[model samples]
Target: MHEPIVEFQNVSFSYGSRVALQHVNAVINKGDYIGLIGPNGAGKTTLIRVLLGLLKPSSGNVRLYGKNIKEFKDWHKIGYVQQKATTFDATFPVTVEEVVAMGRFAFAGVGRPLDHHDRHRIGDVLKMVGLDKVADRRVGELSGGQQQKVFIARALASDPDLLILDEPTTGVDVRSQHEFYHFLHDLNVHHRLTLVLISHDTDVVSTHVSRLLCINKTIMDHGCSIEFLLPSHKHNDVKKNEQIFKRVRHKH
Candidate 1:
């Protein structure tokens, strides 16, 4: 069995009187690629914040790599790419290499210059994401798709074991979306990196991610995508299940 990388035990969170998450429980195992889907205002982002330790759960516990979140200090082992991460000012003068170098600052001290090893890691991640040729180009010069890769490269520069991306392809072109997902597949298969992709593109997500986690304030469903897509033994039951899933996955 795969080891658990993240575990939420009876996790619940609230904003004053408003409950964002209630009694949420789930386990993300190593080498699992999970697609998180939900409608708007479904507490998806809140769940992520709680997992990342950005928010304290009102009642429950979270564990990272078998240690309580409060005691887990190996943050560099996880990489996060936020929504529309490619929307930076096009006129920014930073080079791709420089931007990727930011990921190393966590290993290298803040305000401290990157050493030889840091520079090597930056080059490796740029090549891994196929951005080596454009390493010297200004970030603004790249297409939206390429800019998105730059952020992914930045995340990988830390050699993180787990990667979490939130709506990564928000405004990219169709072709870029294809390329980005292909790279993600490669990373998961070849590198054995655990991945959590939060997206609303149910059609595309179902095809790529191995597991599906559907939520709306709480977990509506969680299982292999194949289980959700394939028909059950009884035809009527299959139709009924599909209808229920459609309702939960309403357009967001």
Candidate 2:
């Protein structure tokens, strides 16, 4: 069997006395599109933070590419697209190309200038995300969806093997969300990019993600999306959402 690309073993975390995560264990294999879904305040963000090495687990371990996350120094191999509200700098005057180029700074060493290869990669990423036409536009001037795409492009500019996104489709129109997911699906199948996504839209998530993880302080459920759609589990509101996703997916 192939080794897991990301794994959490009995991981737990808390903010002061309030426990946020409790003995969570999961393994994400290569090329898996895993969806994390739950109601608000379910420690989804905390889990993502642990994977990113931004928050150390109070107990247990997080491993990336078969190594301890703390010992993994090559952060560039893991791309991240945080919630739009968390990272966008609206007043920044940088162009889309400039913003995407920032991804290389982590590898270029401090104060080093971008080389021709870096510029070429930035252009390629912009084109891949359909933002080449606006490459010269100031990032602050773009629409919310465009800005979100630029953020995704920036993450891809690093040529990461795995991409983690937190609520990537938020605030976008339905069409844009569909386009983005389609793009991600192609990236996963064609480029073999492993994707880990967290979203509140359970309906849409069920349609695109191969596996679903319902998290609320701990993992409520973790398995293939088809298991979540079984008739025995189809009565709850959340399950209804999953059924709707199945129907919509079939229609497409």
Report each candidate's C-alpha RMSD, comma-separated, in the order given.
5.4, 4.0
TM agreement with the true structure for every prediction? 0.87, 0.87
lDDT of each: 0.84, 0.82
lDDT of 2 by residue, 121-142 (tens): 8888888889999999988888
Q: After superposition, how far is residue 40 of candidate 2 from its true place, in Å?
A: 1.1
Using lDDT as the measure, the top candidate is 1
What is candidate 1's lDDT per residue for 156-224, written digit by digit as tens?
888899999988898899998998899999999999899999976665776678777876677754432
Off by over 4 Å in 1: 221-252
Q: For residue 156, what is the lDDT in candidate 2?
A: 91
